[model samples]
Target: MSVGDDIPDFPATGVETIAAAARWAGEHFATVPAVVDGDLRWTFREYIDRAESIAAGLVAIGVQNGDRVGIWAPNSADFAATVLGIQLAGAALVPLNTRFTVTETGDICARASVRAVFTVDGFLGRPYADEFAAHRQERPEILADGASIITFDGTGEDSIELLIARGTDEHRREVDARVASLRPEDTGIVLFTSGTTGRPKGIRLGHGQLLRAYWQWGGILGLEASDRVLLSNPFFHAFGLLVGLLAALVRGTTVYPLAVFNSADALRIIEAERITFYPAPPTVFQTMLQDPALESTDTSSLRIAVTGATSIPPSLIRAMHDVLGIERVFSPYGLTEATGVATLTRFGDSVETIAQTAGRPVPGVEVVILRPDESQADAGEIGEICVRGYNTLVSYLDDDTPLTDERGWMHTGDLGTFDEAGNLRVTGRLKDMFIVGGFNVYPAEVEAVLSSQPGVSAVAVVGIPDERLGEVGAAFIIPKTGASVDEAELVASAGERLANYKRPRRYFFVDAFPVNASGKVLKHELVASVTAAPAAG
Candidate 1:
């Protein structure tokens, strides 16, 4: 099927949704706690006020509609307020991943033509202002008024609190007053694509796209007021930013946010906050569930858990429910392009379905599976996934090339098939599928087999370039329960399901994989890790 073959009229309600949440909170329990940080709580009313003041800060600094501002901080209440302030001020937002090095962060800022950057002096441990000063010095254009350093905890320059404190009540009113002028079609933010293989492109998103995805996913997943959502994931990415923060706002609920991910701290907060909901990258949840305090932590209060970022193992989904005592763990499949939720396994699906399938498409969106032969896959046949809808991103930022091309469909470079029940099971990135001596080897398929075996808790399969075979497979395993797992036993497990040519010639049983904040194992890092071994040479 071609890209342009989309059905029209997928209605979406976006921009005004936030106003509804604000009005609801303002009228009902305005003084009730809405955001809980480290010993800090902000009531719904207070949150609105803080957001207003921050917007005033932006306005005073000359930010306006269409202006791009960089939010370079960890997950914090200030980070939430800063984003809201950007929204209220009618400015486009660019959230800088806090894990990015000074050089990497500077490159994105320069590329995006970022106007202002709001960051902390030191967070968790890293000193921001000093490192950024050097990085910015290398490429000096993106700085805002020496680029206006607005710190969260007074560690960098003037505290984010002070930026608000200096603004008058009238200034704050002006900020909120400007919110009335925004539209659903206006570019809310340029969500950058993760640069795993190429330069990161900004995924252009409008108000309608984000809001519709939130409500649509919220309906399927059920986000409610009584649910105390614990958000420890980074707020810079869409998973943490929109799905975690914005979703909570739309649902009119309490969100306990953390500046950085600390497993111990998150568990402590979950217990103390009586957190009822959590949506994190699978890797984060898996590691958190493995914590020694898992049994003792009052996680019994947790009702629903949502996992995303990368494809989560079915084993992980089932383990969380049975072992951690969570009622359900939903897997929402999406990218920044779809806002966040495109297809998801909703509540009440069998544990097998919840773990194996990515679930059906959201009501308005259309998905098609087309093979290289230009034909549709009858259920159970794998093909490239193409999607089109109102919530879909229009194009890559700064470049008008429609992300989906003339055909109206964005080709997701993933291989998967639909079941009789219509649940989509993603196999692996199409590009990652390697050919070893004419034998096709899907890394994810091998990884699944490896991780399912006894004593193997985590597995990542990668292709290593070889002279004669063209490319060969490699497997990295993280042993179960912190035990010392043997390499021979693991290799033999794979040899059962996989052909001799498809099996890995080399293996790595490590303490952990080099993962990003979102929990994706940097497969490229695995390449480096494997090649560095003395045996490989």
Candidate 2:
């Protein structure tokens, strides 16, 4: 049977809105541990109650049903609660990346017209509230009038605790009424793109779309109430919010939120919390595998591992099973525009398949590769990957330009090819592809070949200006711990495996490549760095 054939239907019905889904989970998994953070633990019922109280507080603070509320905090139980509370109050959520500058944050807040922002005072020694205050002072006209900044932990009047304390019986009734009035088509989230190529744009997604997509995602991962999930990805990103937290709520799984990712801390949490489901980017797993203490660490509880967002080596997949003892590993392909997911690998896929290809499209979603002329590409032919399904974004926030064409296909700017078995192998971004002399060289293809080279832990390939060929490939590599890379050996290996045009003309050994929150390498930054110092390579 195909991957889709054995998948079960969505577990519940009539739960169109996120508010309703939270209520349903609370009733079904009332006594189950919903969140575990430091010394705090809350059951599903208690978690939902807290979310409802937050909703009441939002209502009491003059937030309207159709307004937008921003959450600028890290991944914590409080962030999770605030997300549901925004939904319960019938307001769309706008999650701000914790790494964003004040200018970037202010731009998004103004564009999304956020009514209130929930932040923290000190996270990683940075005061988010103070930074936002500075932003408001610098660009006062950009923000909506009376936009409030409420800290998650503080004693002042603007603290989230104070806001929650203001929840009265009347406000609770108002929250309930708003929740009941919510529609599946109502906007649920406005997530900004990572802005790797250019300025970030807000992608708006509805409640029903997120609910349906992640329900199947959870089912495919075999998520169950007995599972303990370690959410290491940032909550601002779709992988953490929709796939990690929201899916856990639907599946009744216990969640342990990690605000920051330190391999040692991650291993300790897995051993301490008995974390069964762990999902993160390939970098996280690679770092953990390279940690000297990995051999002695107790990670026996880790069962399912999900990773993607960059080229993955099959050897890494095998090491996850042989070394980490993980029973299953999956790699998925998605972007901010497609609700953070489009294709996923099945449970029984081979390590080679899981590492090389992003697997088949999810149930109810149609994926096809179209050439530049708008014709469908044959199997094994590279083209643009387009998606059409219930999970497509509702719209670009405040932008009238339509993302989908007349046929309802959302043309993703990603390049990929499908095998005979319908698995997609994402080659690279459309904008990232460069022409060498006359041949088109895809960075991902070269990066994949170089990743198999010895001593190479991670690699990112970008095209640089070449006076002779117009553009040539340049690779920035991060060597394995205590391992040194020989440039002559890499060149010889590349000549054997890749064509002359595809081989990187220059290589730069670096400590690390700059990555966004989703663990995607910022290629533009790599190119800019190379441009500034032409002699470095």
Candidate 3:
């Protein structure tokens, strides 16, 4: 039997576009609490209305169909509202990571040619709006001509309040017209990759692709109106925006947006709000389990837990069930190009399966293991994971490069194998990339930055095992001949150029690298050297 062939029936099957999904949610789940952020609360009816107003606001600000709009704020009700609003206004949503430096954010804005960006001030002691303004002033060509930044809490002309106030009856009509004209094939989102190929590529996903994949994902998780979900993941990621938010929206699940994750606070909210659905990385659960408040916190409300990592200890899964009282736990696999999800473990899966594998492919999606020569791998043979289905991305923005082959399979660059029962065990990655605290880091991207540093002749980065974080980048640097390199200066330079997560945790000054016959640096040897030498750095 084909994968995705046995998908169960789900609600809102006729909702094609995100605009229609919002309207459907309002009509069916009206009066149901949709979102809760601090003191702000809104029912589905009110939430949809507010989103429509934002749509009108965007139209009033000269946004047109197919235009790209950006949101550079933490997880909040306004961020969620703007997401649906952009879709309603017939614009593609480009979510910016809050942890990104000004240069990184500016590059995305320039690449996407975003017309306007919605942001907030005073998040994590950083003035996001002011920093973007400085970036624009320093590098005027880094953003599209006339691109504007609108802050959520400001009262200036560029404030979101004024933008919303500009919405009139005329703009509302335009927004409605745009919504009615939307098609499933139209682009709904443009999510950038983690620079796996040295430069981040914008992934274009269609309305139908997101709705189909995530609707099924939510259905598989048994999401419903009674479930209150705590969204701790940042909205900039695919898992947070599409899997956590969009899936919960369609299922009538009440969402609680947590901008930052604190173990004590998470436990407090879970108990107070009776949050039933919680999804996070393995590190989060580990941290919560270690928190002293765990003993006093009432966590019986947690029913479902979802997580994924390179390596998940089976003991952790048992602890989550035995300690936290979570009834269902799922481990899934996916990437940005695959619409955020391709497979998921079922409800009754064993603890070992949930921990050791990423489960089988989702309904309507096909996953296969391919050998180096593009042949199908045996059930137990590890090879590149390929995906083909409606969930595949429409294209990469501004690049004519074809991601899918003639057979319509997109190579995932992840090494994995399928069990006889269709369970997929992710073995390793074909690309020189690693996940640091659930965020992907590409060595080439890090090397690109380190190579530009003044005293660095060559640099190679590799993922080293970290107890707290799954993995972290370790940089091996070769200084220019007769030039002294200061580790402190390099650290400061990297801190300025890269996000905190992407920065190397350890720096090793090396004269030469272990190379192969073709002069390729052996990254595995570098990783092995760290294991052999305790204080190599």
TM-scores for candidates 1 onward, in order: 0.91, 0.97, 0.82
List the pairs of residues colliding in candidate 3. Answer: 4-363, 4-364
Ten-residue region with minimum lDDT total, candidate 3: 1-10
What are the per-residue Cα lDDT tens digits for candidate 1 across 224-290? 7677888877888888787788777766678888766777988888788788888877667777877
- Candidate 2 regions with alpha-carbon error over 4 angstroms: 516-519
Model 3 residue 317 lDDT?
Answer: 88
Q: How well is each residue in 224-315 modelled by candidate 2, as lDDT tens digits?
A: 99999999899999889988999999999999999999999998889888899999888789899999888888898899989985579888
User: How are the candidates ranked when ordered by lDDT, highest leading?
Assistant: 2, 3, 1
Model 1, residue pairs in steric clash: 3-407, 3-408, 3-409, 4-407, 4-408, 144-147
For 177-288, candidate 3 gives per-residue lDDT tens digits of: 9988999989999998866335778999899778888778888888889899999988988878987889988899999999999988899999999999998987688779
Cα-lDDT of candidate 2: 0.89
The C-alpha RMSD in Å for every predicted model, in order, reads 4.0, 1.5, 10.9
Tell me the deviation in Å of residue 361 in model 1.
0.9
The candidate with the higher lDDT, 1 or 3, is: 3
For model 1, state the Cα shift of residue 365 in Å: 1.4
